[model samples]
Target chain A: MAKSTITFEDINVTVTVPAGTRVIEVSEKVGSGITYGCREGDCGTCIMKVTSGWNHLTEPSVLEDKILRENMAGKHNRLACQAQVLGGEISVHPV
Target chain B: MNKLELHDSDGKPKAVMLSERVHWVGSLDPDLRTFDIILKSANGTTYNAYVIRGSEGVAVVDTVKEGFADDFFSRLESVADYSEIKVIVLNHLEPDHTGALPELMKRAPQAQLYISQKAQSMLKALLKQDEMSYTPVLTGDRVSLGDRTLEFLHTPYLHWPDTQCTYLAEENILFSGDVFGCHYCDNRLFNDHVGDFRFSFEYYYAHIMRPFKDYVMRALDLIEPLPVTMIAPTHGPILRDRPDRYVRRYRQLSSPSLASEISCDQKTLLIFYISSYGNTRRMAEAVYAGAMQVPDVRVSLYDLEGGEVDPFVDLIEEADGLIFGTPTINGDAVKPIWDLLSSLTVINIKTKLGGVFGSYGWTGEGVPLVEDRLRGLKMRVPIPGLRVKLIPTDEEIQACHDFGLELAKELMGLRSQKVLNFADLA
Candidate 1:
């Protein structure tokens, strides 16, 4: 129902996505630079830090939480494929 | 356009400073392709080496590939004199790191070569130099370099049995060979500059370190308490800004969570047996009876003698618990048991309960050996292996049954399921 602005800090790119859009899909639409392998949460290829608007993203699944918790990624970090736009501006730094 | 110039003005390889006296002298294969003939290295790769200048003498941490000898030596010579290089520390004996070792040993003939105890025979066989003398180092072992101290951590199977991680006490830098490494090659040589190398790092782990996850966890735990400011791996960019991140990533990747994710709902138990004289087969039946005593657990028994009578492998993959019954032959488990164990390694057995039971004549080492192997595969062993000598007595058979019950209880505990006591149900 709402739009969220997703900014890719590394490439200085940004795109607008509807509520609950995955970060990987946003990156694909805007040609934002985000390297990924296996796209699934298991491989951890699309790990990215939410530089801002952490609360704007959707909740992480059990698998994503497990992997992120394992990698010692902070609350600000979320796998691009797993984290969705809940509805606000979110800035990301791919790790 | 290499940022470090680890090469002189005229393109001759040179050493670049990492901190003050610490230098990076490893060579880069910009055009090189694959790594270990398995993983694809699209960005090529780097054979990282380090030169630490202590107050008395210098120490070379590792070497580059053999084909890059000229470049490697040039870089080594650019920073310190070969004769002044007092120590050559080899964290691993893999060819990628030891390819230029023979030439390096020839150049720095007087330098002491340091390797792990497990590496002694492996290095000899790998280099084909049986008589070469090496100083064997172990976990917590230290070799002083006048002002700085190099401590060795015997972290085996970080990819190889002989692998070790070297820590520099003064700088608090850990020379972690292949432990936190990837095949990523770039002029930007630090995690801060490289942005995110998650894919390359994950790919490296999937290909190289997946089979030896247990060791990876052990190494992480072993190094967690150290005041490590930097991680200089044998490949890719060094982790300086946030070395802890990589360590945490390793812990996450190696966690049993990945293996346990297979998700089996039914409590399955596999009892496989090989009978030399029917004694072990009887033990298997006794254990199966005990396991069947517990409710809701699906039990599958397979005689591994003829091999193809049952789909033991398919059953093993689905089982939540495993029990092996074997006859000791010359103080060892039978060949089929060994073959089955080897095949099980390729399957995910983490978080599963495992036990060994066997019949022995002169030696009872077979069960214990199987237990050790199962433990090595990261299986949870809830009870000591049941070993019955010769023909099992009624008491011995009961003991095996009790062992099986204990294993079943442990499995229930692991899965956090309530055991259905027939008395309580009644």
Candidate 2:
């Protein structure tokens, strides 16, 4: 599987995350300026918008579907803690 | 019909946008007089649905009834597109909240449904959507929608087994389902905007939330640690400015120690009496007057002659002392007094002071029998059966009053000595 390049546009940072890696973990490795709470998706602290490549992220879990359904506005947003990289490149923007 | 026609002619929304990301997309039934053929809603009601817009997804917290589908969906559309909505959370799966679910599902077909683990079968059965897919969330479960996370807190028996509350972490908003809801419809949308809703709020509490006081306390304890800035209940005005005020009020209402007047420096005495020919009633009146002599004691008198036993049973659970009066007939207490005493034995009445008095035409076995029942229930009988032959004279009535004072003294003595004991140990 190819590594997915995730860019944290707000912090002007980018990181190569392997497929199936959570965006939150990748952000932590690259030292992105994203805040988080209750990393299990209970807290929407690490919510981020995907500027591009929304489908590159893995399908949200039952919990993530609810959080996104409740707080997010568009299809291009995902919780960094719960959203895993599937393939291709993705851009992350702090909401 | 004209008013309704004019209202529909105007394409404006009755809903209010509460914040940058939150919209109060609920419907108001201003003429609804009753709820579920019970629970009087004099001020009508509101079925609240909220639209929360996160950076990447749009979610609807709950939906209104089917009759108000146009109003609910229009209000929802005023904020966001239905097709764009990705998820719908049913904090409570009651029909009033989910009446529009079928229609909502049809319109927002892309949206996934979320309900509590316990509500899965019920929701499916209720909607008859056995094949529908839904995510069953637990207490600490979390869902993320871009830059926002919504946490579900399982607070069962806020009147239902499958009830839960949604917590928006970034906004510090608690969509508290039915836990803090009242059947009030207001366009104002918030506690600060609405003036003095305390009466209806408490009324709603007593009717809907009172039976679940234990769960109320538990739910309060669960959310105590969260930085809750707003309480957006599925009904009535949302608590945004002072959410803690409602939470604290609920805490005071549900605390077992604060259930009645006994929590203060006062004790409550409940007197149950049956007077066949005004004799036992007179003795009960004397007991009531005598008990009132104590500065910090509350007394409630119930006539067993014509009333039901259930409410008095609730009073029995709260009172610090029990006093029974009966007119002895055929060597036993009147049937009503016996009925009251029998019900007392079935109840787990706590240790408290007990007093019994009676008016006897012949053999006065009734007073002793009442006393025996009290003793059987583990009550401390300070004043033994005060048996009087027929109606009591003025002097005997005074003695009956003294019997009441004895009970008050015993209660005061019990409380004061306990305090002293605790102080000494400390």
Candidate 3:
């Protein structure tokens, strides 16, 4: 049970979160502006680009991975519900 | 094959009701209406898996999709005798209909799998995974329900290869698969007590069976002679009350489309967004400039200006592809685009592709934001989407060319893809 601090770009607000938390939930908590619908891991709505810390995030879910497989994931994108932050400092853009 | 789950005292067909073994779980995409979401969000689903009680043996009919195997089993345990299941009647082999086959067979080893001959081969080709078992039945194969009779009718083109319908003469029910079915879910099992069956049935016919209207017409002709009181589909509520009402509706669907009511085949490109200063509109026009290069791609753009609440379903119906453009609003997409996205709850369009374009000053994911909303509609988008910074650029225009070319190919297929292979089937 490890927790780590995550940062948001614009506001520079950081919050402690449990390990394996998706950037989406983190963004939601800090109000970092991510749009998402169909949270069942299909719709690529909650996708975010791993700008700085891709390693801190777990691999995307099968649905997200499928989108990537089809080469449709937005540039540097991953679904937030499916992506987990192993947590450290990470940069995410809600693309 | 049926082992006779229920029978009248004089050896006729009867049950407290049929197949107490079935269960329905929550829908995967409630927001997605194709799965006919009812009973808390499992869209367009009945999750039908029935357990039969027989004198000599027991069996289950159909199964939930792989995603809902756990749910199917748990629900089966509540009403039916699961441990004694002897045979599983697989009327069709669509993955959604057969997703739990392997899991169910493994758990109930004693039960024999029963499927139509065509369905057996289709299932083999479909569930190509090894270690499967089944008993094949073709037309006239009668499965005894102790004293009652379960008859098999081979309906090859009932939406899929090797599809068939099962008629339990004793119970006077026809377990229809994709045919004569709709995409709506309800807690009530019978159609008699249910709300509007009109929409679900029409949607199913229009979306799934509209193209195959001719065979459906022939199929209707074949069923005219049978005195069926109940029609239970794999999706939506069972029709026990007025089965003919649904049948008449199906008949009308098979009837020829009037020249006036025929949905226009004209191509449409749906562009969605909000432009503050005409910067995004310029980029969108560039995308359109590229899209128009391909012949016959009619296009429409929505500014979402002045709080327009128009859902634009006709455009959704017409478009082969959708291109979205939006500038950053507050921290998310402009409220207008968000409002449009929210209203797009039901899009029966399938296999449509898309693109996202935008321009903004110090943009915080403007193009990506709109693209995400488009993806929620289940439309595919080609890679390397154009995202112009502040205005359309040479590179953005180049990206636009690629998007148009990719969409043009897909639209070409819709126009020319010989979907009417029924002549060969017949």
Candidate 4:
């Protein structure tokens, strides 16, 4: 399995994990301060900006997309709990 | 519309009529000393129920308390027969509103029950009738009885989850369950005819509805746009004389500014604590003072032991920063603090600045445990937990103050960063 690196810009920390790792998991591993609730893409609390490497993350699920639209989040926003690292480096910041 | 023949010998109407089609079929309890074991009802109260005759069938909105079923049934019978009742609307499931429900269902066996979607489980549990069936309604759902239409608005948590308001389309009357109601029992029936009840009205708001001010605001928003000529609540006199004034008063009372005088740009920090020996109270005061020192930050300090936690839930939900103070007893934080934390699950407090501070005699596990819980709830804790041994010295108090100041600064920094990020995105 390929590994991907996630850079938490606000907390100034980076972590490398295997592919298919959720952004929330990487956040917990490095204490990157990306706060989340429900952990199931329902609360819209873990919304973060995809500062770079947008293609490195998986597509948002239907529920996540609906929540993002309801929150009026822009195209750059993704719920950390719902977005997974595919295979490349990604950089994000909590909104 | 004026039918002078309907008046009794004394000029008082035998049946309280709000309009040509709607009638007040409710019971008055002028002797009620108290209500729900908390509200002090000096002038007693009224269980306001209404009967809407729609040329085809009748719809009954709510009922009196259990013991007053006879009064409710007699009034109901005067306007329409038990068989004529086609729809029963339960706006709220509280006992005072639904106490006569079991009997009413028995008499009006063919009538269908309508309630908010959230009241499905509550209906079965409250009446202890597992087989009871009801049509769950939503915000825009409506039911027609020939000519008149009843539109439901899902205005929940005005005080209870199952709470809702019904609008009479033709008459423009809002059958609000408990909102804009008081504990005053008056046979005059209408707000214009009743004696002064401003005290009871405000008192009712403070006791029953104040705890859920955020929801009150939400409920107000839902009902404000309607062309309501009258507000017939489940309690107190029906508001037909300038009903909008009462609605405006509810809007004023539930406004966020009434809780704390913080403007939109300003931040709010809340410090909640429970003290067994006044130690934690002192610590909370110091934290409040420290947080207040920061410009554009409003601080509120509450002693949880003396007050109920429900009122603070909305305040905390709107706050930018929160600090919990406790006195560790038997290796744990007090029950009130834990109760308050548990209640936060219903609201999203994610990324809000959180801190834990307390005074303990021996083990200071209370502070760290709360901090861990806050972290689990997704709150951004900027600093470690602060603990003081037993009573705090002058230096220890200073440390507590510094803790609050640091947390407030971090909150301010986060707000600024958010503004900058939004600007960049724009």
- Top lDDT hit: 4
Candidate with better DockQ, 2 vs 3: 3
Docking class of 4: incorrect
Better of 2 and 3 by TM-score: 2
| Interface CA RMSD, all predictions | 24.6, 30.8, 25.0, 11.6
Candidate 1, B313-332: lDDT as tens digits: 54565577889998888988
Q: Which stretches of model 1 miss by more than 4 angstroms? A: A1-95, B258-426
Rank ordering of all candidates by TM-score, starting from the highest: 4, 2, 1, 3
lDDT for each residue of candidate 2 in B1-426, tens digit (9 for 90 to 100): 112211234766645666788878888887888886547777788889998888888999988877887888888877788767888999998888999998999898898898987787678668987689889998899887798888999888787777999999999999999878887766566777665677778878876777667778888888888999999998888898879888998998776652443557878888889887898788889988988888877888888867887667667756788898987888887787666666653234635667889899888998887766665455556455798999799988998898887777777763222111111221
lDDT of 3 by residue, B316-391 (tens): 5545677777776555667766666665543344346666666767755766766655554544543334566676
Model 1 chain B lowest lDDT segment of ten = B417-426
Candidate 4, residues A1-95, lDDT tens digits: the string is 78787777654556767788888876755544577789999998788889999999999889999888766576789999999999777888777
Query: Judged by DockQ cut-offs, is candidate 2 incorrect, acceptable, medium or high?
Result: incorrect
Whole-structure CA lDDT of model 4: 0.83
The true-versus-predicted C-alpha distance at residue B257 of model 3, in Å, is: 8.5
TM-score of 4: 0.67
TM-score of each: 0.56, 0.56, 0.46, 0.67
How high is the DockQ of candidate 2? Answer: 0.01
What is the clash count for each candidate, in the order shown?
A: 1, 21, 13, 0
Instruction: Give candidate 2's error at residue B321 in angstroms.
Output: 9.2
